[model samples]
Target: MAIILIADSGSTKAEWCLVEGKKKKTFFTQGLSPYFLTGEQIQNILEEELKQKMKRVMPDEIFFYGTGCANPNNARLVKKAVQKVFTGATVAVDHDLMGAAKALCGREKGIACILGTGSNSCFYNGKKIVKNSPGLGYVLGDEGSGAYLGKKVIQHYLYSTFDADLMDRFDAKFKTSTTEILEAVYKKPLPNRYLANFTVFLAENRGHYMVENIIEDGFNDFFFNHVYKYRESWTLPVNFIGSVAYGFKDVLEEMCHSYELQLGKVMQKPMDGLVKYHTN
Candidate 1:
C-alpha cells in the first residue's frame, strides 16, 4: 500500500486526505498559513489534530498545498511545521494556486483559479505555473472570495439597506450586534476568516433578491479584476477549484456568461484530483 497524506488548504481550514493504496479517509483542522501563523504555532495545531488520525498508518509522503506557500521561505516555514508532526515522512510544500492548476487541468494547460476564504489565480502550462496574477489577500482584493461576500452581506446589515425580515433572520442566526462584529473583525487574528464564516449563512439565504445581487457583484469583481487580467491564460478553459466557486456555481456561471469566458469544471475540493495526480 502506498501511504500518503495530501492536504489542500485555505486560510481558515485544512482538509486532509489519507490515501493508503485504494482506501482513503478524510480529516479536518485549522489551516496553517504562513502569513498568519508561525511555524511553531502550526506544529502545535498539527500535533493535536493530526495525532489521532495517524493511528493506523504512517504516511510515506505528505504533500501540503496551502495559501502563502509560493515563496520558498513560506514553503520552508510550512515544511518545518509539518515535519514536526510527521517526522519520518518526506514532505513537499507548494502554493495553493499550483494545487488548483494541477487538480483542475491535470497535465493540460489551463487557467486555474481559487475562490475560497481568499482568492488566487495562475496560468499553468501542463507541469508548472508560468505566470500568476497577484492576489492582495482579503482586505484589498480577494474579490469573489467568501470573505468578500461576507463583507458585502455584513455591510448591508449594518447599513440597514437589506429587507427587514432578512436582517431579523441574520440577527437571530448569529446573534451578533454591530459592536460585536466590529470588535471581532478589528481585534481578531484572522479577520478574513471571521468574515468569511458568514458565507454559510449567506449561502442559506442566497435566494433573496438582495443576496443574489451581492453574489453576482462579488463574482463580477473577481472576473473583471483578477481572472480577466490574465489575458493569455483565458484563451484556454478557465477552471475554478474552491468552496466559494462550487457553492455559488450558478452565480459564477452567470458572471462567466456575461464576460463571455469559457467556464470549465468547478470542483469543491482539490484533494481527490491531487491524490490521482500524485499516486499515478
Candidate 2:
C-alpha cells in the first residue's frame, strides 16, 4: 500500500499526518522555517518527531504546506529538509495559502481566507489559484489576524483609548516596563507573532466591547483592503481556515453579514482536506 505524508507548518507549530493501508497517525512538531530556524535545527526536530510515524511506513508522496515557505527560496529549503527524511519520495512544497485554499474551496470556486497568527486571502477557480494578495508578513499587512488585533490592543492601551478595565487588565498581566515592551517588539525575532500572543487575553474575555472593537476593526481592515479588491459582478462564496477564524467564527460571521459578504465555511485545520485530497 502506498503511504502519504502531509505537513502543515506555521510560525508556532507544525502538524504531521501519516496515512498508510487504512492506518493513520498524527504527530506535532516545531516550525521548520530556514529563515527562523537553522537547517540542523529543523532536521533534528523533524527527525525526532517523525521517527515514530515513519518506523513501519515509508511515504510514497509528501506534501508540505507551510507559512514561511511562501517564498520560493524558503520553499526549496523546506523541500530539501523533507527530502532528507523521506528519501526518494515525491515531495511537493507549497505556501500555507494553498492549504487554506484547498481546505476551504476544495476544487470548488470560492474565496479562501486564512486568519491565524497572520492573515491572507486567495481566489480559487476549482483547479488553481487565480488571484492572491501578497501576505506582507506580520508587519505592514496581515489584517484580520491575531497579530493585527494584538497590535491594535497595544496601541489602544498605550494611547489610553481602551476601556479602563481592559487597560487595567493588560497592565496587570504585562507589568513590563516600556523598555521591555520595546525590546520585545523591536529586538525580538518574529515580533508580530510574539505580539499575537497578547490576543489570547482578548479571546479569554471576548465579551468585552473593547476587545470586540479591536477584532471588528481588524476584520473590517481585511475586507476593505484585501477581500473586496477583486470586484466581480457575481457574488462569491467566502470560506476561512485558521485558528483565529475558528475561534471567532461568530464575530467573523457577523462582520461578513454587515459587509454583505457571504460566509461559506470555516475549517480549523487543513489536515482533513489534505487527507481527502491524497486518499480520494
Candidate 3:
C-alpha cells in the first residue's frame, strides 16, 4: 500500500502524519532544526519519536514543511534526516511558510498569513508564492505574533502601565518575577517563543481589559505592519493559519474591520486543509 507522510516542523514542536491505504495516524515530537539542534541531536529525537510510527509501513512520499528550513542548506539538512528514516522515499522539503500557504489558499488564489509563536504573510497565486513579507524571525519582525503580544504585556506590566486589577491578575497567574522574565528574554534561547508563552496567560484571562488590549494591539500590528504592507489598497480574501489567528478569530475580525481589511476565514491547523486538498 502506498503511504503519505506530512510533517509540519515549527520551532517549538513538530507534527507528523502517516496515511496508508485508508488509515491515518498522527504523531508529534520535538522540533528539528539545524539552527537550534545539531544534526545528530535531531536524528536521536526523530528516531525516538518517529521510529515506532514507521514500524509497520514505509512511506512512499514525504512532505516536510519546517521552520528554519527556509534556507536551502537548512532544508537539505532536515531532508537528509527525514531520508534516513524513510529510505528511498520521495521526499519534498520546503519552508513552513509554503505549508501554511498551501494549507490556507490551496489551489485558490488568495493571501495566506500565519500568526503563531511567530508571524508571517505571503501572497500565494494558486501555483506559487509570488511575494513574501520577510519574517526576519522574532527579533526584528514577527509583529502581531504571540511574542509581540507577550512583549507588550510584559512591558506594560513592568512599567505599571496596565490597570491595577489587570496587573494583579496577570502577576498572580504567571508569577513571573522580574528576574525570571528578564533572564528568559536576555539569557535564554528562543527568547521570542519564551515571551510568546506568556500570551497563554492572556488567553486564559481574556476578560481582562489589559489582555484584550494586548491581543487587539497584536492583531493591529499584524495588519498594519505585515498584511497591509503586502496588499495595501487591494481587497483580497485573507486566510489565516496558526494558533493565535484561529483562537482569537473574533479579535482579529474586529481589528480587520478597524483597519478596513476584509476577513475571509481562519484555519486551526494546516494538516486538515492539506487532507481536504488531496482528498477533494
Candidate 4:
C-alpha cells in the first residue's frame, strides 16, 4: 500500500486526492497555472491550502498535473513548489494535456483531448505521447474550450449579434453590465478564465439553438484544426477528459459521428484515472 498524492488541475480549479493504500481522501485548492502564478506563489498555495488540509499525513509521492506545465521550466517550477511542501517526497509535475492522455488512454493506444478552461489534444500509444496538436492558449486558439464558448457568447452579447430573446435571457441571468464584463476581461488577471465564466450560462441553456450553434462551431474548429491533425485521430479510439467535453458529451459525440470517428471515454476530471494509473 503506497501513500501518494494525485492531482488534476485546470486554470480554474485543482483537485487533490490523497491515497493511502486503497483509501482515498479528496481535497481542492485554487488553480495553480504556471502561466499566471510564480513558483513562489505556487509554494504559498501548497503551504497554505494543501498542507493545512492534509495535516501531517504526508505522502511519499506527489503527482501534479496542471495547465501551463508543458514547458520544462514550468514543470520544474511546479516540482520545486511541491518539493517545498513534501520535503523528502518524490514529485512529478507535468502539463494537463499529458494528464488527459494518461487518464483517458491509460496503457492503451488512443487520442486524448482536454477541453476545460483551455484545450489540447495528443496521440498517445499506451506508454508515451507520440503526437501533439498545440493548443495556442485561449487568445489565439483553444477551440472547443470553455473559454472559446464563453468568447462566442460574450461576442454575441456585446455586438448584439443574436436576437433580443437570447440577449435578454443572458442579461437577466448574469445581471452583469457591459462595463463590468469589460473590466473583468481586460483589466483583471486571467482574462481567459474570466471569459470562461460565461460558459456556466451557456451550459445551463444547452437547449437553445444559438447555444447549440456555438457548441457545434467550436467543436468543429477543434476537430478540424486540432484533432484531425493527428494521424490516428480516426484510426484509434479518441477520448475526451475535461469539464467542457463531459458536460457537452452528446454534442461532442454528434460531432464525432459526423466525422465517422468513434469516441472513447469522456471523463469530467482526470484525478480518478490518474490515481489508477499511478497506484497500479
Tell me the whole-model lDDT of each prediction, alpha carbons only: 0.87, 0.83, 0.82, 0.88
lDDT, residue 223, candidate 1: 85
Candidate 3 to truth, TM: 0.93
Indicate the worst ten consecutive residues by lDDT in candidate 1. 226-235
Better model by lDDT: candidate 2 vs candidate 3: 2
lDDT of 4 by residue, 93-126 (tens): 8888788888888899999998888888999999
For residues 105-187, write the lDDT of model 2, one tens digit per residue: 77778899999888898888877788898778677899989889888877887788987888788888878666787798999
Q: Which scores greater on lDDT, model 2 or model 4? A: 4
Kindly state the number of residue pairs that clash in model 1: 0
Provide TM-scores for the models.
0.89, 0.92, 0.93, 0.93
Q: In model 3, which regions exceed 4 Å deviation?
A: none
Top candidate, metric lDDT: 4
Per-residue alpha-carbon lDDT of model 3 for 158-248, expressed as tens digits? 8999888878887788887889989989998789888888788778878877688778877877787778876632667888988888889
lDDT of 1 by residue, 1-280 (tens): 6589999877778999998888888999998889899998999888888867678577889999998898899999999889888888999999888888999989988889999888888888899998788889888999999999999988998999888999899988999898899988999687998899988877898788988888888988888887888876457888998889999988878777878888888999898889888888
Point out where model 1 deviates above 4 Å. Answer: 36-48, 84-88
